[model samples]
Target: MTARWKDLCLDADDPAALGAFWAAVIGLEVDPDASPSTPGPVSLVGPTDGHRVWVNPTTTPRRVKHRLHLDVDAGSVAEVEALGARVVLPAEESGFGWTVMADPEGGEFCVFVRDEPPAYRLHGVVVDCRDPFAQAAWWGRVLGVEPVHHADEGYATLEGAGPDDRLTLDFVPVPEAKVTPNRVHWDLVGDRDELVLLGATHRWDTPGWTVLADPEGNEFCVFAA
Candidate 1:
């Protein structure tokens, strides 16, 4: 893989509180590097594969809808709600059996039912773009995964179920401009210079990571690792 799925970066006003909520939901503990008043980002390191959940502090309130969001599977939607999530769209039983929900900070996500147990609870990170195929292809190169374009439903996805992949990233079409910083973003781990050559725009830099926006203006971090 050219790049690894390092972590999920969540921007919130109260990093520790939000991080704690996600920690419980994802069935992980808050890492020693985080605290309620730590004045920086808090993290919940995943059990396997060294995945990370970074809860970052931000004063910006969410203004518009998110172009990308998370999709997780659990026994019940209420289980997630009990941990500080709320229903944004009620349960849908038809095509995709899931419920649209929001976190306490108003970041949108979806919850689906999983009949079988999961290895890593975080299912997939979804993106909304104008051209799903193009977007997926670009990300596929960045993540070093195969891009399987779907022209029927107008979306493209890579499940990471492939023998050479390890993380799933999906893209669907949307007809609107992205107007705000995403509350939820991914941390891309790989060569910074190579990522820039792969159609990523270096937006800014944090202490240990560089913020890069995808072709669709979706911001994700490229960790120095």
Candidate 2:
């Protein structure tokens, strides 16, 4: 019993504003049903389904680097900065061909500038872990996807789950352990009991879904399919 990828969720102090910033950066439209004046969750949608991003209300401010972040394709760095994003590290410093940027609320996401941007801007969901291989393997089992290990680069990837072909779930190596709940997380539709059997720790339950943390303590929600 594998979980299917549902939506990416972000905890934000100002859901409307943060949602707007992400929509502008990723070329997604703010959900028409969302009320701008309300202090609730705001959702951003692409032209198709399965790539929705939800900006959820949270009183806690970010205190450290995000454990889970997004990597997006953009036309240029300047264009994204114009949307109120700050460049934490330029491409020159990254060694990789991407620029590290932070949203209005200080959530870090990488931007890869291309001469011509792809039809889909959201590139991948990246998780920083102490063991990329093990984390990737565990998530691969939960999602029922094959994990591609890049030992040289110290990363692993799970491709071809969501609607967009360009989107991937990437696990990269990091030195520090997770100290707090991740501000960003993904949701899935699957069997909650099966998830627990597969080593997920039941975190808590809400009215709609049950929250479970992976072996590394990264939280994700599972809903009945």
Candidate 3:
């Protein structure tokens, strides 16, 4: 059997505090089973449908713009600001149809202003890399995303299994190289050794999961299945 995408992991110093922030943002509760003093990832599931969110404890701090980020449809600008999200890119500033914003912890996420109702609040996941094609293909294989879609040199994307069940993945090119642990990352269920064979470099490890760096040094994790 192969592994599957499990949750979107955010590395933060305070797992419970960060977890609580997202819990309120998404209307999900912290998993009751999560130990407050575990000193690791605390999983949050809820208000239903889509991948779970995990706030992972880390000593690394965010130093620059995030290479990977979530896109949400958090209410109006007032509501978003009230919830501690601030604008990074106003809709009028970018050609894209989404507004770039950052969470309380400064994790970059976009708020897509759409007429249709928001899809479980979370919409898309964006990754920045030096080569969109290679990164997209690598993650596609690791996550079982078949026939990955290759856009132009600037962009690439692939949809997940169920139509509306999970957020889509988008890979876009950036000039700078990733030199530190990514603040945002994917959490999956798979074998660490197998993943290493699949081109992931083992970085650090924690109980039930192994932190790995992708071909480009982007960090992610594999949980035992």
Candidate 4:
């Protein structure tokens, strides 16, 4: 009924370097042509049904707070803490229990222990960037989803049909790039037509995905089958 974690967001002085670093870490194939439209570069990692990383461009130095962050399940909290991430504040038990964490970059995202998955799996993944339209254009070529809704360029969503019904992709904008490597990303699957209409633009003759920038210049993936 709604969207879930779509893609990873990474803030870096050099988007290309960070993207390359992740490509190696995740065993994701590097498609050079998939760079973002902004002066900065972008890259796609992994298969459609696995996970994807987005490298956001930023010149601002790491600061006091993060606009958004992720709470990942790496088996245990201690497991991720050992990787150099810190707790901004101690994890708390809420009406609904959840864990709060600050990534290596000091951003905040929450993790929840759930008993059930969404009724319908993610139809498609999305990445918020500087120019949602431009990013949509890039991904439209990657996935075959058509633009179904637009919000004053603030957001753009793509739609595709599956065994059940059509899927959607929504790209939103934020003020700045994330200061840490993204622990949560998307795994795009399905056919290229399903991908292209979603707003992925073709850069090369790759089998899947096209690199693109968001309305605010953030990077995201457009996985094609």
Instruction: Please give the lDDT score for candidate 4.
Output: 0.48
**lDDT (Cα, tens digit) per residue for candidate 4, span 16-83:** 75566445433455556778655574765555523455666776676544433433333445544655
Estimate TM-scores for all models: 0.88, 0.96, 0.86, 0.38
Model 3 deviation from the true structure expressed as Cα RMSD, one decimal place: 2.7
Give a tens-digit lDDT track for model 3, residues 157-207: 777632245568888889998877788877777899988998889999887
Candidates' C-alpha lDDT: 0.77, 0.90, 0.76, 0.48
Q: After superposition on all CA atoms, what RMSD does each candidate show versus the true structure?
A: 2.6, 1.2, 2.7, 10.2
Candidate 2, backbone clash total? 0
The regions of model 4 sitting more than 4 angstroms off are 1-8, 14-44, 92-96, 112-225
lDDT of 1: 0.77
Model 1 residue 40 lDDT score: 82
lDDT of 1 by residue, 1-225 (tens): 568776677888888888888777666678884654667888887765356777889888888887888777777888888888998877764446778888888888888767763655667778889889998888787767788778888988987732124446789998998888888887767877888887888898878888888888888878767
The prediction achieving the highest lDDT against the true structure is 2
> Candidate 2: TM-score?
0.96
| Ranking of all candidate structures by their lDDT, best first | 2, 1, 3, 4
Residue-wise lDDT of candidate 2 within 1-225, one digit each (tens)? 289888889999999999999888877889978636779999899866687888899988789999999999999999999999999999898788899999998899999999999766888999999998999999999888889989899999999866576899999999999998899999999999999999999999999999999999999999999
Stronger candidate by TM-score (2 vs 4):
2
lDDT score at residue 50, model 4, on the 0-100 scale: 30
**After superposition, which runs of candidate 3 have C-alpha atoms over 4 Å from their true positions?**
35-41, 47-50, 147-153, 161-166
